[model samples]
Target chain A: MKIAIIQFGGSNCDMDVLHIFKDILNVNAELVWYKNKDLSGYDGVVLPGGFSYGDYLRSGAIASRTPIMDSVKKIANEGKPVLGICNGFQILTEASLLDGALMTNSYPKFICDWTYLKVENNNTIFTSRFNEGEVIKIPVAHKEGNYYNTPERLNELNNNHQVAFRYVNQKGHLTNESNPNGSVENIAGITNSKGNVLGLMPHPERAAESILGSKDGLKLFLSMVDYFSNE
Target chain B: MEYYAEVTVQLKDGMLDPEGSTIKRALEHLGYSPKDVKSAKKFIITIESESIDKAKDTVDEMCRRLIANPVIHDYSIIMREA
Candidate 1:
């Protein structure tokens, strides 16, 4: 499956994401800068993690207004898969591609640590390889990762099963200690109403290899490849 | 004419204010009353314009587009008429 990763001016993870797709997954992947509007050939697109525009106004606030996001939004509306990680998640929120917004962490400090995430909804293409309630360890590094949504939207996410991941303890049980950024209901990731777009705060690319600590993140990338291969 | 505008943006009440909480603690340590202190960002902009309406519109646009993320921040503009 061919994948296109969007790279904005301040994007730092485009290379890492491309490397994993090329070397590890052995999939055809290319880095498309923010200025490029052509994305007709790729099977999927990824908004990789980084402090786009230095997180000056707010994380992903500036990057969302870049010219390429318009096309990304168009591609997403067509039922293609779009995965956003870290600041990419923030960008999705800013662009209104995903529901809710990410606020500063309750801790009020930059948090950089390994976090355990529970697979809340494995039925989606992004988590099809994992079982429901499965615990996966991934690294999270961000100052503004706290997710917030209105009451109606939160209920909608629950009823629609749009929540993809939640913070969990080492025993795979949801707990406050495992809530790295104080996200409401310990939410760590969510999908759009159509389930075609995914936004997650953790860095799955950072954990794609066992050398980085765990290979659990590989399942996500593999799931995407598997999904596109079947199509 | 040169007009100076100061924009102050703050988190709405009932929202978690980690930065304000941190600053409040620091003030308490400094032996100030520190009863209630909220933190907000201030932006000072100087614009040359021919009319007040034009300057206000331009600064308002800047606030919405760059100075603040409307999702979280509420900003008030204070313009100094020259």
Candidate 2:
């Protein structure tokens, strides 16, 4: 399937994701810049993490208003899969494609480490390869990764099972120390109402290889391939 | 006429303001007791308009569209002759 790796002005992880898709996964992916609006040719889209626009104004505020974002929304409306990682997740929320806002970390510090994430739902194409309640290790690096929303909305999202991942300990327990950025209810990832749009705070692309200390992320990419391969 | 608009954007109440909390902690460590602290952004923009009424409207739109996100932020604007 053709996937578009969207790149913004200050996006540094664009090439990293491109390498994962092109070299590691051997999938057909292209880097589409923020200004390019035509996205009808691509089957899916990936918004990788980075400090876009130097994290100006807000984490993803400026980038969400870019020209290509309208196209990203268009494809998402067409039921195409869209994966957003870290700052990409911020952009998705800022664009109102997803719910909640990623606020500054509770400690107000930039944290970078491998975090354990429990697969909260395996029903979606993004997490179907993994078993329900499975735990995977992925790296997260950001200061504004703390997720926040109204209590009513958070309850609604949880009731709908839209929460895709949650921070947990190595033993798969939700402990206070396991939550690195103090995200609400230990939420690490979520999907939109349609389940075609996913926004995750961790960098799965950074952990897709064994040499990088984990291959857990490979299943996620493979799941994407498996999804369209069936179609 | 030229008007300068000053906009203050702040996180809404009941939202966790981590940056503000950190600052509050530092102040407490310095022996100052503060009930709480809230951080905000002040944006000053100069608008070219025919009247003060029009300048206020322009700055208000700018805050709504760009400077402030209605989801988590509330902003107020002040205008004066440049």
Candidate 3:
């Protein structure tokens, strides 16, 4: 299945994602500019991490309002897999495709480090390759990744099984010290209600190869491939 | 008529404000007895409309649609004739 990596001005991680899908995974992936509104030919879409629009007006606010996001929104409504990473996650929330808002980290510093993410839900198309409660190591690089939502909405997300991942320690125990961004409930990733749209702060593309510290992130892309193949 | 509007966008109360807290802490370190610090963004906008009410509507719509995210922010607008 062909995948489209949406590229906007200042999207720095497009090539890395392209490499993981094209050279490593042997999948057909192409970088599509944000001005292109047609995504009709792709089976899935990836919004790679970077400071879009120079992170002005808010992390992803300017990029989210671009015309191409309308096309992405339509693709999401059609139930195709849509994965957003780091600043991509910020864009998803700003576009209202995801549920929560990502604010400045509690520490208020740009954190670039490896993190452990517990797979809270394996039922989603993006997380199908992971087992429930599995802990995977991925690297996160961002200044604004603190996830927030109203208490009521947070509860609803939990009840609906939309939470896809949470920050945890090496032993997979959720602790305050492990929450790099101070996100509520240590949330690191979440999927839309239909399970087709997934957004997370971690850079899975950066962790796709064993040389990159861990290859645990490859399973996420593989899960997408399996999902599209079965469809 | 041309109207100008000033919009103040701030994080809703009870939401964590890391930047604000950091500033507050710095003020304390400088020996200033500041109880708290709140941060907000102010935008000056010009809208073309026929009446004050119409300008108000346009500015409000802009704030809701783009300038502010209702999930974590609250915004207020002050409009006047330009």
Output the number of the lDDT-best candidate.
Answer: 3
Instruction: Residues B17-52, candidate 1: write the lDDT tens digits.
Output: 888888889888888866777788898889999877
- Candidate 3: give the clashing pairs: none
Model 2 lDDT, full chain set: 0.93
If scored against the real structure, what TM-score would every candidate get? 0.92, 0.96, 0.98
Name the TM-score of candidate 1.
0.92
Backbone collisions counted per model: 0, 0, 0
Q: Write the per-residue lDDT of candidate 2 for residues A1-231, one digit (tens) a residue.
A: 899999988888999889988998789999998888999889999999999999999999999999899999999999999999999999999999999999889888899999999999998979989999999999999999998888899999999899999999999999889999889899999999999999999998989999999989888888888899998
Model 2: native contacts recovered, as a fraction: 0.53
- When superposed on Cα atoms, how far off is each prediction in RMSD? 2.0, 1.4, 0.8
Provide the TM-score of chain A alone for each candidate, in the order shown.
0.98, 0.98, 0.99
DockQ scores for all predicted structures:
0.57, 0.68, 0.94
Residue A231 deviation, candidate 3, in Å? 1.4
Off by over 4 Å in 2: none
Relative to the real complex, the DockQ score for model 2 comes to: 0.68
Q: Which regions in candidate 1 have their CA more than 4 angstroms from the true location? A: B1-4, B45-51, B61-66
